[model samples]
Target: MYKLLIRPLLFLFDPEKVHHFTFSFLKITLRVPFISTIVSRLYQVKDKKLERNLFGLTFKNPVGLAAGFDKNAVLYNDLADFGFGFIEIGTVTPKAQAGNPKKRLFRLPKDKGIINRMGFNNKGVEAAIKQLKNNKKKVLIGGNIGKNTQTTPENYTSDYTTCFKALHPYVDYFVLNVSCPNVSSHAKLEDAAYLKELITEVQKINNQQNIQKPILLKIAPDLNTIQLDEIIDLVNQTKIEGVIASNTSVNREGLKTSTEKLDQIGNGGLSGQPIKEKSTQVIRYLAEKSNKSFPIIGVGGIHSAEDALEKLEAGADLVQIYTGFIYEGAGLVKQINKAILKA
Candidate 1:
């Protein structure tokens, strides 16, 4: 129904506008008493086999909604009804700011993909905390934190720490979003030396708390073996929790989308079906190169149960979905969990 009846209708309008509309639609419909119960019955999958014990928290299932989808920390509780084991919210910054100019999000239906340069355009960390205050605890939540676009280079670590300190109590785990291509000054964030310093600072603050939350790095899929080796070293050196391999791809190679059309859309990170193989390869490399030293949350181009299985088989301890959720509908979560149980 989502693919045939709802997706086609939603795809007709501007992609950004349709995103807000869907958020509102879900918010309104889920509030209609028995509607929540019925939706839960249809989508929820409960099996002891589905639980994933990773880091310190035990996930209800392996499937999660990735960060970009619920940017402000809203809708996670509502989305939990659709049987996700966890939901990651935000690439939130220290201060609120309008992101890149309009027409920044595009869809490539031919490749079952999306290109977005949304620029971490989320409400500031404080706003997210306010929304998260009402957390129902129906699902485990991961907070994805990033620097404000206009933040000075000297303050880059400060920005990540600000969001981390503020969201630590609210979210179960934390993902340092240093690899998003849409953000400004992208090069510094990915620099191995800079990343080490940044992760160390976040860890210092995390240690002060009564309970330390797991910290993970979200990396881009464009990294080669050399970079992947650096990532393994970074994980070992920092001793942070795990890695979410990966975030999105800036590589446009082998896309079925026409060159003229892609050029018109301009620069953005690609997600969904076009990135499945690339994402899995990175996962396999990290797992293999590091001898499976750290847990991995696999994401990128997962549009079906087979895709999720591929991620899991490649050594991802848990998997996340952002574009896949948009393209394959909420049923895909239940589908992946069922397939996990079957396997």
Candidate 2:
């Protein structure tokens, strides 16, 4: 029904616009009596086998909605009805800023992918905190936080520290986002020394609190083996909780999209099917090299139960979806959980 009826209609409008419209649509329709209950019954699969206890929090399932989808905390409870075990909100910055220029988001339907240079556009963390405080659902939540666009590399620690502290009480875990290709100067923070310093600083703050929340790193899929090795080493050294194996890829190879149209789409990180293999390779590498020393949340281009299984086989403790959800709809979550149960 989604691909045949809803997706086609949603796909007709601008990708970003459609995102907003769908959120609004869900927000209103979900408020109708028994709507959420019906959605939960249809989408949610309850089984002890699907539970994942990681970072001291229990996930109802391993399938999660990736960060950019619920950039703010507005739709998490509504989206949780779609059967995701968890929802990651925000690549949120400390201060509100408009991300890159218009048309920073594009769809590569032929490739079953999306190219976005959204540059961490989000309402400031304060607004998200208000929403988080009001959340009525028991679904697990992860906060993917980043420095503002104009923040300097030297001052990056403070930005992350600010967000970490602000969101600590609300989020189940925190993902330090330092690998978004859309943000200029942000990738430099991925340097081993820089990452180690940043994580250590955030860890310092976490330890000060009564209960420390798990902190994870989100990396790009484009890194070389050596870079990934460094990242693994940093994770071990920093004692950060885990890693979210990818954000998106700057590489455009193996895409089925036409060159002319892609050129028009321009510079941005590419995600979806074009990234599945690459992201899986990164996860496999990190898990093997580290001897599975730490947990990894696998994401990028998961469009089916098979795709989710491949990540789990390759050593991901859990998995997430964005583009796949866009292409496959809410049923993908149930399919993944059922596959995990069958396996």
Candidate 3:
């Protein structure tokens, strides 16, 4: 119904507007009696075979909602009803800032992809904390945190530490993001030396707490083998739990979208199908290079069960969906889980 009906309709309006509308619609409809129950029955898959224990937390399954979609924590419970084993909230910053202006999100339907320069626009950490504290479900949540847009790399660790301290109690795991192409100078933190220092500083704070949450890095798909090797070494050195093997890609190579239209769309991280292969390649490289030394959460352009399987086969311990959920609808999650069972 989504591809043939709902998606076609939703695709007509501005992508950002439709995103908010869908959230509002779900929030309102979910309030009706038995709605959540019915949705859960239709979408949820219960199977002990799919359970996974990684980074000290157990996931009901490997499918997760990637960050950026639920930039804040508002719709995590509602989204979880759609059969996700876990949900990752935010590329949230220390301070809430209006991201890049209007039209920051673009859909490339022909390519089954999306381009977004939303710039980590989230309602800061405090707002998400309120929602996290209110969470009633036992669903596993991963917090994907980032620095404020205006913050320079020199003092960026402070932003991450602030968010880490604030959200550590609430989220099940943490993803340190420094690969977002939309944020100015964010990539500077991705340098091996800088990343090592940043991760070390965060670890120092994490050690002070009695119970330390697993910390992972959200890297870009654009990294070369040398960079991936350095990251693997850093993970081993820092003893941070894992890595989310890819954020979106800045490369526009081989897109089916028309050049004129893509050019008009301008600069942003290109996600969905265009980056699937690249993401999986990164996962494979990291897994092979490190000899599967640590866990990796795979994400990028997963639009089907096969796509998810490919990620797993390439050595991703868990997989996440952002554009896939947008293109394939919620049923895709259930479908992927069923595929995992059959596999």
Question: How far does residue 94 in candidate 1 sit from its true spot (Å)?
Answer: 0.7
Q: Tell me the tens digit of each residue's lDDT in model 2 across 47-125.
A: 9989999989999999999999999899998999988899999988999889999888899989999999998999999
Each prediction's whole-model lDDT (CA): 0.94, 0.92, 0.92
Residue-wise C-alpha lDDT for candidate 3, range 1-343, written one tens digit per residue: 9999999999999999999999999989987899999999999999999999998889999999999888899999888888899999998889999999988999999999999999889999999999998887758998999999898767798999999999999999999998999988855778888888889988998999989989999999999988888898898888889999899999998988989998899999999999999999999999998999999999999999999999999999999999999999999999999999999
TM-score of 2: 0.99
Candidate 1 residue-pair clash tally: 0
Worst 10 residues of 2 by lDDT: 182-191
RMSD of 3: 0.8
Instruction: Give TM per candidate.
Output: 0.99, 0.99, 0.99
Q: Write the number of the candidate with greater lDDT, choosing between 1 and 3.
A: 1
